[model samples]
Target: MIPLLFENLSIENQPVSMPLPNGITLTIKREDKNHRFVSGNKLRKLKYNIAQALTEGKDTILTFGGAYSNHIAATAAAGQAMGLKTIGVIRGDELATKIDVNPTLKFAKMCGMDFLFVSRSDYRYKHTPEFLEDLQKRYGSSVYIAPEGGTNTLAVKGCEEILTPNDAVFDVICTAVGTGGTISGLINASAPHQTVIGFPALKGEFLNKVINNYTNKTNWHLVHDYHFGGYAKVNEDLVTFLNVFNKNTHIPLDPIYVGKMIFAIFALANKGYFEPNTKILAIHTGGLQGIEGFNKERIKKHKSILDYEEKI
Candidate 1:
């Protein structure tokens, strides 16, 4: 059996830059700093899944993702570190020849991940029986399929470990929702007195159902107004906010997940949404590896890039 690196990680709370209403205390749980590549929720999500694979005698882990997916990058890195093979079924077939230009794919390739590029239309059927059967036939039965965004029963179980006894002091636990796995785990683990709030990075009402499938806890709610536009969508205000927030706090936020979540938290704070003296803890789900790809797109459009790096 392969051991996980830094399996018992100590996540710290960094106070958000001061000057807030009602004297509310806001701190971010730095889950992003958990690992170099397989950081944040990815580390937590993949922990037990990889263990299960090893126990089942699986030699390869196959997963699905888009061009700039953090899940794809993290899965590859974790598989490499664990001495297992990694295969990424990328969403866009056009990205096959562009791997060198795509930062996320490039990094995954560097970690020894093989690619199976598929068309967007075909990728939509990733969960369908026919598509899954094709994958099993192609990769052989020895491969364990990790769902897109790395959300599964085991993934949620792993995410449940994100919060410890020390987190009970927080009145509100917050995290960015991708496939709702992380938030679901948080919901199940949260104290009855605590409320779990998820800020989605995409536009949709479907996540409520996705989350419900894993947890029966009623203390969680989703805020849908802060996605900017949709998944992987961004605007100038968000970019500026990320740069300025990092400048003030010296904590780098990936533009995709944590950046949007932190932005929404501040917006809610400014709107007098949080109660007086409420202690809010936001989980920083890492995807900083995608920053290079994001900046590349921004540079092509002659726009400002994310100014912070993980080293900060």
Candidate 2:
């Protein structure tokens, strides 16, 4: 059954059509198309976690996430597919009543995920032993805890499969970092000659520690200039860039992660960040599932939604 989720995995490399400076050739690994529900890094992160849960005879998987988190959606779907119950410990208690209006939560509910909503303050202690003990008491011993954003050693092991021998030709490999799991795996698998660049979706010096906890590789570095005021924060320029980028390359980028990474890559290339004839491969870690909920919020605010929302 685990193999079923990855049957459609397609990491096809597609070149971007753009007038970039320094003769840097940009190509994207379409890991987004890996699965329908458990796409991209989410799928990779969840693969071994699910298997381990089943191996340990766990009947349920418990995790944490926000309203439109890709990890939440993917975990719910994986649980449903594997016949395991899923418990989502959501960040906002208010979102408990708003699931019907929120695409990610609603979809998770449809996939048989039960939610335990908590206030943001309480969510900070989610990894604490006392909080975990409480969860065990509430959900019983049959529950397996999958960390928020699904970033654990097992998840990193799964993500290590993201790179292949064919990717060695690229001088640089790039990906968007959230909790730093995917990039950690990429760093481990990257060739010594390849510099792995990470564009964080949020601003924090803490990510270095997070990434360091997972791998000992020294070929990776994070660029802090393009988070756009932090996680899930978007402006008009980003939206316009996403639309125009999709129109030009026919590749849809989710605003939270990949969109920012792509924008940064373009801006950096234009600034001559790479030398001439350098080949760069960017990983498209899919969070496109959240675009619907995001555009819904934009519509309610009387703002422009992503123009390519319908295309991908």
- Best-fitting candidate, scored by lDDT: 2
Instruction: Write model 1 residue lDDT over 71-90, tens digit each, in one string.
Output: 99999999989898999999
For model 2, what is the C-alpha lDDT against the true structure?
A: 0.92
Task: Give the alpha carbon lDDT tens digit for every residue of 265-310 in model 2.
Answer: 9898888888898999999999999999889999999998887934
Candidate 2, which segments miss by more than 4 Å at Cα? 1-3
Q: What's the count of clashing pairs in each model shown? A: 0, 0
> How far off is residue 185 in model 1, in Å?
0.5
Clashes in model 2: which pairs?
A: none
TM-score per model over all chains? 0.97, 0.97
Q: State each model's CA lDDT, in order.
A: 0.91, 0.92
